[model samples]
Target: MSVEKPEGPGVIAEKLGAWIADVHASALPDRTVEIARLLLLDVTGLCIAGRGESYVRATLQATDPGGACTALGHAGSFSAFDAALINGTAAHGEDYDDTFEGGPVHSGAVVVPAVLAACEREGLGGEALLRGIAVGAELMCRLSLVAPRAIHSAGFHPTAVIGALAAAGGVAAALRLEARQTTSALGIAGSMAAGIIEYLAEGTSTKRMHAGWAAQSGIRAALMARGGFDGPRTVLEGKHGFFKAFAPSRAPDFSPVLETLGESWIMETIAFKPYACGTMTQPYIDCAIALAERGVQAEQIRDIVCEVGEGTVHRLWEELAVKHRPPTAYAAKFSTPFCMAVGFFDRKAGFGQFTEARIHDPAVLALAGKIRYVIDPDNEYPDNFTGHLRATLNDGTVQEVRQPHMRGGAREPLTGAELAQKFVDNAQHGGWNAALADEARGWCETVFGEPALGTIARFRQ
Candidate 1:
């Protein structure tokens, strides 16, 4: 007979944990494994490149250096957790990390680090890393969908808050916890959950630190649960639960978590970013660039009007109103006008566009001045991160462009080769040696054959 599944926040967490474990133990298809491998390369590259940032530098200076794992651009050693935190933040430092629409957050940076750290500490292999990623991503997406947009509207950075619980759950699943123990871990994570949207008001290093804090906090929660520490079972749906406290507008449906289980994986829907800006602004950037490519010059253009969904405006353009006219690298990265302007003037927006010199470019600023945004009530912002760009050029010529999605998202994913190249490019930024990079890649490629994950751990060390 088919059994009835449990309900409520705590039970949902428990059931989701079991579901993640089951998916990992079963054979994952070749496509999923390959995707995981590509992302591993990409994230590792980012970790290396971002090591010089203030947060990562602080971590390097504060921690006892060990050769556990390679920090992106520097030669240093740190505890596994500290390394993961630094690496995770570094990967996402440029806002070029992967994202998902259903639950608007960067899943890989927060989840991948937790898995990698656990794999190194527990002597696990690639297959185990893949499983941990699956567990963490699945739980994160499911929970993010639970409250839908409520948690975010409440000023919580899902990547850091819900992502923490998911990261912890992924680590716990990798370690093979029972239902009650896993639920206890969720309870533990629930208490640790914290992140805010204050970073947008003034672009600061805290945003980059959120992913690391989440990954580290989750690891701590899992370890505590492993030692039999008990926590609140109804953390998500309790009287003063996460949803109730954080998102009171509309309650999230928990059925999505159990309904699919292993069948409909959220990992498949992940979106890797091409431009290093807010995910909401990507579509707008893409559209703006298209207009510029079609012989549209900034000086010749009369006015550039953009229509975007409310969610996009709220999350990006409106939320960062003061930064619309950016004076710093972080501001430019988060600003709609700045991203759109750079894409139009430069034909492309990448790491280079957000540089100290580019932020003050006269051409970019002039283009940004002509650009104005209006809410597209009909357009899909959060759900459909597509936008409509209308450019009125000299001689009264109007050019319009629209993009439903950018490359690297599940709908338009990057090829394995492209992901590999991106990793190499980012890795080089951190000054990683080619020989070491090749070794790391080779280790990941041959991980499954090894009898124990001990060898893999040595590679990082």
Candidate 2:
């Protein structure tokens, strides 16, 4: 008897393929292209500032010989896939990549590298790259929306998993694949999608590789589809498929995936991080900074009360002790108390503050020791990053501040100028020259006008 085939991953892939083939680069909306440019700027900044990181350096060394693609500060020559694996890892090393609320996926880390790799190999122009980025990001974000909570809570990292299919769609669109081929590529990409949240259990570099793996796997999937390979036709909806197998908690909504493809853009919902820590810790950091500014000295504070929403405490403060004293710099990025303490004392938390030296800083630790977190059952998590802080001084005076929505999120998106400044600051840390950095920024702005990506690919090297 023949085995009945599941069609979920395959069907979603097919529609995605059709979308890519039908959407012409020139037809993309002006606003979407502008959003793509912003994402590129943000990703480029992360890649630059994150280069000096040991994880980035180690990844570069492990995957050397990347051809024509830049790996931040390193000079190496490898295959296009290798370039994606290394550069993508570097971009996400600091967790400074862009985040999407509909889903927690990191778009730029996976999509940008894959598009750049395909553009380099095909000699595609900036317009195609921009369109591909937009399409890829949309697919990734929509997929995230399908079962946002279930997929995330099930211990899967959406950035590394759904992101592969998104990149595949983008590449297929850029290369002008037929609808059938595009669908097949998505099917193939589905089989390759995998990422776990186990990294949160410790500060392992495994998380860094998720984005790289997604980028490389998506590129390979697209290549296979281009070569006439057929993949499952219904990979998203069928029994034992992506939605069912990976996320069984809730039924996914497929409408968003096939919604007004060109008119409604998910890339517009992307949020760039202001802090180098986990997204969950951002609101707390803001609250701490505000409290410190109100003349609350670290020593004078008795018990620093944090009335956090249920979701933040459950996801971010699960292991309260660890959050109080993180063992490594990577672990520090996920520690709410550590991030909050640093923000309270410094008023800013950059890449430098998460270092081992800073993690062990007495002042920050002292401030952290005063923290007492109280979960507010009424406060909903994730719908929005809301936070509350109450500082009780030695004299028994309590001052409180509450933020409904974290800065730099959907409710408070960063301005173009603010994002550009972040990019420049991150690039300067990555060691890019003022002239070269300006040139890079310009290239990203008008990337659509260029005839081919040969220049940009060479720059990645």
Index of the highest-lDDT prediction = 2
Candidate 2 CA-lDDT value: 0.79
Instruction: Give the per-residue lDDT of model 2 (tens digit) for 1-461.
Output: 97675545446666667667878767777777777888888887777777777787777667757365555445555676877787689788888788877577788899888887787777778877887788888888888878867876778887888888888888887777888888888888889999988887777888888888898898898899999997777777867677887788988888877787656787787888888878767888899889888877888888778877654554567687777887788988888888999998889888778888998998888888778788787776656677778888889898888877767877898888888888888888888877777887888887778887666643543
**Could you tell me the TM-score of candidate 2?**
0.93
Model 1: worst 10 consecutive residues (lDDT sum): 452-461
What is residue 193's positional error in candidate 1, in angstroms? Answer: 1.0
Clash pairs (backbone) in predicted model 1: 48-72, 48-73, 66-77, 73-430, 146-252, 271-409
User: What local distance difference test score does each model get?
Assistant: 0.74, 0.79
Model 2 scores worst on lDDT over the 10 consecutive residues at: 66-75
